[model samples]
Target: MASAVSENPFGRSITTEDIVDTLGFFDSWEDRYKYIIDLGKELPAMPDELKTEDRLIRGCQSQVWLEPSEQDGYFEFQADSDAFIVKGLLGVILSAYNHKRAGEILDFDIDSYFDELDLMRHLSPTRGNGLRAMVQRIREIAGE
Candidate 1:
């Protein structure tokens, strides 16, 4: 049988650098947010059956589910969220972590990346916490 990992190919081609460049191009946070939502729209839909309780991530202001798998030392991720902004946030996080080797994912300075984006400062505390939760979970999966 084909693995669950294979069933879901990461169709998003945007890279972290692409996000950074795009964010830089936007002068206002509102524009940046729009871009983010656009990015979320690019994420392929995860199968409804895969969005089970086990995949549900806690501590998010929005309902988010992430299912991960490993192949040839790289990680594959499939995620969805009830909120548009949160789904966009997932897209951002995925740009950083998806299809990366565990060491690369671990070595990445996510906080610095956020700082560069000036992202956390604009987010509500709850949303910020939720973003952190998603990052933490990805790290945990990478560390495994």
Candidate 2:
């Protein structure tokens, strides 16, 4: 695994730089979707043990599990979902916030980032709501 430095000037685990780099690699939203799905493939699968009640994310139509761990003073997240789109959304969240301190992740300007990417407006209402739920669950884990 490629390790990112723990302290980032941007105060985000995954910077706008990372997202820009990712976007540059794909030619179209279809290709981007493929890349996003591929990112989901890279997520460490949530353990069956962690799939109990405590890890479940509320407000999601699918069964979503998120397990957070702190290593080397950085928070790392492992997540999974039974639904494909939810899995992809989890990938998006992980790409942005995994491997950061709780404070940094909590401080990240996520709405601005999503607006810059033109993401939420393009999504269906349900998917957008589910995305917000995912972010909320992660933020809650960060204790924000």
Best by lDDT, which number?
1
> Candidates' TM-scores?
0.90, 0.81
For 28-55, candidate 2 gives per-residue lDDT tens digits of 7877777667767766677788898888
Q: Can you write out model 1's per-residue Cα lDDT over 27-143, one digit (the tens) per residue? A: 999999999998888898999999899999999989999999887777878999999999999999988888777878888889888888889999999999999999999999999
Model 1 bad stretches (over 4 Å):
1-12
Cα displacement (Å) at residue 105, model 1:
0.9
Clashes of 1: 0
Model 2 segments beyond 4 Å from truth?
Answer: 1-16, 25-27
Best by TM-score: 1
TM-score of predicted structure 1: 0.90
